[model samples]
Target: MMLSEKYLQIRKHSEQICEPLEREDYVVQPIVDVSPPKWHLGHTTWFFETFILEAFLPGYQVYNPAYNYVFNSYYETIGNRVIRTDRGNLSRPGVKEIYQYRAYVDAAMLDLLKAPISPKAEELLLLGFHHEQQHQELLLTDIKYILGHNPLFPVYSTTAFKLHHDQTKEREMISIKAGIYEIGYSGTDFCFDNELGRHKVYLPEFSISSNLVTNAEYLEFINSGGYKNFTYWHAEGWDWININQISSPMYWHLIDGVWHTYTLAGLQPLAVQEALTHISYYEAYAYASWAKLRLPTEFEWEVAAKSFDWGQRWEWTESAYLPYPGFSKAAGAIGEYNGKFMVNQKVLRGASLATPEMHSRITYRNFFHPQLRWQFTGIRLAK
Candidate 1:
């Protein structure tokens, strides 16, 4: 696809994800981790304006000077902006205004792409495309969070998304022979900097499940008092469950002794056959402990990823979010993307249904705090 076409398609998809949302839904940030839908729309546009239009397009006019302060997300080098927690507090530059901002920037971005562009500008444009795609995934999940948390448990769209149903194949472990393996992104494609620095790691033979842990399987854990059993949980995970009174995965509810979960399609009976999602790394670890198994390391996951079907959920790995042997940050605000976030987070391999098309490479390293379960996270066992 042409660069301009790809840009428009991605930009449109972000807005399309929000089509079912009410104006009120756009401003909700139920938790510090979930940015409001409006914020995502504006922040993604600001990325293009700041990085591509302003930096590359000569005499390009910024749509709104104040948007830089409102939409700038965590580039310390990019100057001060709204903190994550306070994103929901702003009511001005409301949903309509945010959409207008998107249109304004989209026009300038298209104009810039019409002419031959320098390699640096093209690089930033591609990065901006993927960056917006990242936000597109967030937009859907955030919309789910906003609607799912409401007492009404309102539906975002009746047909837009369906929870992943259970795998039909019988569960089995796929054996991987022990060997030194090349890890990290090796392809000459657009990948985040964190996926670079390809290096080798030695691994012993291991077996990983061909299927993700299903809701029925997890329900067994719940019935067996998995949440109550501190033995299965890490010390910190145990504390998180207790302090937050977390008893089940996010959006899960036991109503009249039946399990139901909130989805974009609205509150519905939990399909035990479906792959489990909205789980934290802590939950994944504890569940693995209870099953007398362990989660795969990221390297093990990459090696075995081709052997099984994935992309149903973001599978948690038993690896910390750390840089590779030769990892180095790209200089400037872009450098702040992944390198600095390499602490206190766990690596999640594969991809979730919420992930955008062409965005789920095996080397993609998604990290989040261990206690966060808002994203579509799941588990696969290794031993």
Candidate 2:
């Protein structure tokens, strides 16, 4: 696809995800981790304007000078902006204004793409495409969180969104022979800087499940008092469980002695056979402990990924979110993307149903603070 076409398609999809939402829904940030839908739309637009149009397109006027303060997210080098927790507090720009901002920047971006561009501009354009795609996934998940938390338990869409369910596949462990393995991105395609720095690592023989853990399987742990048992949890995880009174996965409810889960399609009976999701790294680790197994490290996951079906959920790995042997940050604001976030997070391999088309690769290293359960996260066992 042409660069301009790809840009338009991705930009459009972000809006389509919000079609079912009410104006009120676009302004909420329910938690510090979940940015309001309006913020995502504007932030993504600001990325193109700041990085591409401002840098590459001469004579282009920024849509709003104040928008940079409103939309800039976590690029310390980009100057001061709104702190994350306060995103929902602003109501001035509003949803309609944000949409207009998107349209304004989209025009300039397409115009820039029409002409022959330098390699640096092309690189930032691709980065913008993928960056928006990343927020596209977040847009859906954040929408889910916004609606799912409401007392109404409203349905975002009946048919517009659906998660992949893995149930019929028989559970089995796929054995991987122990050997030294090359890990990290080795392809010519676009990948985040974190996936760079290809290196080798030695691994002992191990076995990983061919399928993800299912709702029914997880129920066994919960019924056995998995959440109540600190033996299965790490010290910090145990502390988190007690401090937050966390009992089940996010969006899960036990009603009238039966389990139900909130989905984009609305609240529905828990499908025991479906692959479990919305789990945290802590929950994954505890569940693996209860099952007398362990989660795969990211390297083990990459080496064994081809042997099994993945991408149903973001599978939690035992690996910490660390840089590779030769990892280095790119200079400037772009460099701040992944390198700064290497600490106190766990790596999640594979992709989730919420992930955008062509957005994920096996070498993709997704990290989140271990306690977050808002995303479509799951687990696969290794031993």
lDDT of 2 by residue, 199-318 (tens): 999999999999899999999999999999899999999999999999999889999999999999999999999999999999999999999999999999999999999898999999
Candidate 2: the clashing residue pairs are 178-205
> For candidate 1, lDDT tens digit of each residue in 157-266?
88886656577799899999989999999887799999998988999999999999989999999999999999999999999999999999999998998889998888
Model 1, C-alpha of 225: deviation from truth (Å): 1.3
TM-score, each model? 0.99, 0.99
lDDT score of residue 283 within candidate 1: 96
Cα error of candidate 2 at position 154, Å: 0.5
Candidate 1 segments exceeding 4 Å error:
none
